[model samples]
Target: MKLPIKIALFLMALLSVMAACTNKNASQRATQTNTDKRYSYEYVKKISVTQPKKALQVLQHAEEHKLMSPIDINILRSKVYYNSMLDYKKATFYAEAALNDSDINNRPEQLMSLLYLAALEYYNCGNYAKCLNMADRAITTGYKYDNRRLVGQVLTTMGQCHSEIGNVGHAINCFDRSIIIFKGEVKKSPNWNLYYALTTSNALKANAYLEMKQYKELFQMKPEYEGTLNKLNTLPEGISGVNDLANATFYSIYAIGYEEMGNHAQGSALYDKLIVTRAANTPEGATFVVPYLMLTKHYNEALSKVNEMESVWTRSGKDTIDYNYIHNILANKAKTLQAMGRYKESLETGIRAYDLNDSLNRRIKAQNALRVSEQLGKKMLKKHIERQETLLRINHIANIVIGALLVICIGLMIIGFRINKKLKAKNQAASTLVKELLLYKKQLMDHLAADEANNAKNNRKTLEANDDKQQQYDEFLRMEKMVIDRGLFLQPKLERSDVAKEMGISTSHFNELFARFSDQSFTNFINDLRMEHAAKLLKDKSNYTIEAIANECGVPIRQTFYRLFSKKFGMTPAEYRNVVADE
Candidate 1:
């Protein structure tokens, strides 16, 4: 459904308001905290390199000891994930928590925390529209304060979100702006944000151009194998941002560009290299596994890839909406089935892919809803506090006029006490609502876990069924081989009728035999065998070009050969041959 433009504008306005108010408070806190800076400055610098999980622990200790300001602790809490962990949800949680605190608004770190939370949430959820909104908010705040690094980072993140949602033109605009800041070295030299923003903008611009199918722009931007490899190499070793699974994604895109440019051999080879690099950096031998997904033809391999991605995200405490990674796997697996000539099975896979995508969208929107509720909760809390302060001031003023209206004043005091009691009840209710919101968050995570598990189970069952069918088909292939060896039929274009006649049966009866033995019609079996044989022959560098290979395999046209080879091999004939040769 199309989002109403008016609503989008309204949300943008609300975000602006939130940013303005938060920034005002942040500024005051920043002044107070930095005034006594000797201890905090050294402590903050020392903990910069700490792991996110460990940083959270340290921050918790600081909070307990009353050594850290709520502002400082919140900054640490949010940064623990945003800077160190890459866990978007926790980063968002702490950032939002920090923003909601009346004490932390307007500080540079608080502004950064809010921006980081919003950007990461949008990126992780695949909600480009909201992501862009948050990025705009962050950029606005950062620019107002001359925080160029935050501006650059938000611009790059906006570019990426635009790329993800197919907004090529807008994506490039963001990347261009980010590049300007990046070139100026506006951010601290050693700051990871600089490298991350530049590389992200570059990579995303490449992706945007690729999506547009504009090879010239893509190449002009230096989105090629050699260039990306150089950048990857130049990236500092053990830098968490540069060599992650996402970094390997650039290589994947480069390989894709090569494939699209009709250099499948190079593309396939690059793909192999990409998988190796990704697998190495990916913790626990578990990566996003997109490469394994693209290369392997087997359904089990696809299922395994999804399972591994899910496991890794779970272990890392990453958002479940990271399902895009797994959804891509599911979508590709359907393509693989189509390549394998399993059209019926492919349809089923496609359905599963659709379902998974739908589930992901729903979960993401739900998370966004939770964020909205959190913001609303904070607004209400502020209003309630302000009202209470107003009432206290009013009571103090009323006390001075208390002679004849003493009874009335006492009555007013009793009424105020009752109102306070109700306020207390209301606060308790609000706390319960917050608890429920957290529960909802956990429930959503659990649902994602369950969905993935069920999807894996379903895939395994389908694969087992396919395995059984393949076994039957293999038996039929063996029989066909024996018959061919014996020169059972003279016709070069042998049909099922001939096979049935030779086996002393009617065509219909023979079809039943074919179905029982091959799991598909005789025609599909024949075509699959012919294509498989042609693929094998094509792999022999000594034999033939694609056209000759096609002719020899009894597939008449070059286009048909290209189509069939790609369908059977998950790549073009040349790509398959090159991949085989490289192996």
Candidate 2:
């Protein structure tokens, strides 16, 4: 009887404890129901770099179910695209969309962060102007909000842009300011990004000195290689890829350690390990060991390293291939070859570098031309809209005045119609020009193979000395090949008359010879050559800007270049360059 009572009491006690725990869990669940799943962003961030598609699906699910607001969804989308997908333009779009959201209005820190992200993406897309504009907003917001770390981040990107655009002095200033901010802010609030920013600014400032050839100043900046690594080691393992980032950021800072202090083999080993991370693949992150190798008189090692570097570099995907960086590599190879007393190979490598550089310049020109035309188009549209609005207002006011104003209003309408008709005709004429240029461009582009086949046959043709007319015709053909090969037709004011004079013949004779020898007229032939040259320049972009490339191709800027270039390429020059840049 005593044992049964004890067992019953124990059972009752267990039931009471179980009921209390259930009520506690119920209370916790009720509490969680009221709060949004903002902490769920951690899962998204963790998986984004490796499983972007999955991360996107999660974001979509949260968004469609209204579990998260548009501001959260947009920012997450932007972060995913920016960090993982490597789509800067798309990232910028989402980031800006989030920035404009009303929910972001009350959140100063979030707004500043998104602005910085947008600015960074713009810089990635090579739109330094837009980047700077966005950076200005971010800097202002950060300063106002007293987010010193965020301000430092913005300055670093600004400095990078300045360095790229050849504003070395300004770049250094920005870097210095960023470094100061990072140093002070990190002390107050230590974090992964802040520490990394501090290190990056320091390296960049040193690199700026390297660019200016101020080696003494660079060397004076302490914490060479190992010290840089030690600084990086302060970052905790709580952050993903922190270890890789540290090693990559400090790469080759050891091999030379400013001037000289390490072995080429050791640097090579470090490079192989460091390059596994994408951080080291950037132009700024590349190994600076080749110079050190050369300094140590390791010519063979330098040459081998150059070859290896290029092989790995080209495999880094097309988007990562900076023309200037590639051109620099080639130039270095040329120098290394010359140092080894291989003059012929050095010359060949040097020529390749020059050709790449020239290509880069042409791409820059086309981009500029595209930008100018776009601006003009926007201005024209704005003015047209304004003029129509003005006309409507004037007509409305005139109707209230008198019947005499009716005739004037009608007259104004007639004038507007006539103006519209003229504009239409002008547009039609421009369209016709584009069509003709495309037709010629197509013909020339297709002729490369045929020209190569005919090349051998033309030189092999037997000349009959007894027939003066035949000899003169053959001589004209021979001289034409030389002229074309030497790119003499590239002169802006080149004319058939000039070519005839150079060929020691009259204009009539030159015309006759040209018609008999080729299917194209002088104008068509020259235009085709120019188009071909333009395409070549656009394609070989290694390290050039998007400027008015066809300016030097002897095409008129307003009438011919941009219109024809857009039609031929099926996209505006800037759009095409952006696509290539993205690739």
lDDT of each: 0.56, 0.61
Clashing pairs for model 1 are 22-106, 23-106, 25-105, 25-106, 26-105, 26-106, 26-107, 27-106, 27-107, 339-567
Instruction: Name the top lDDT candidate.
Output: 2
Residue-level lDDT of model 1, residues 314-429, one tens digit each, is 67666534443334444555665676677997899788766666677656555655565566687755664575478558767876666549888888999999997775555445
**How would you encode candidate 2's per-residue C-alpha lDDT over 17-47 as one tens digit per residue?**
1111112223433343325543255456556
- Where does model 2 exceed 4 Å of error? 1-39, 50-54, 224-231, 253-583
What's the TM-score of every candidate structure? 0.50, 0.45
lDDT of 1 at 475: 41
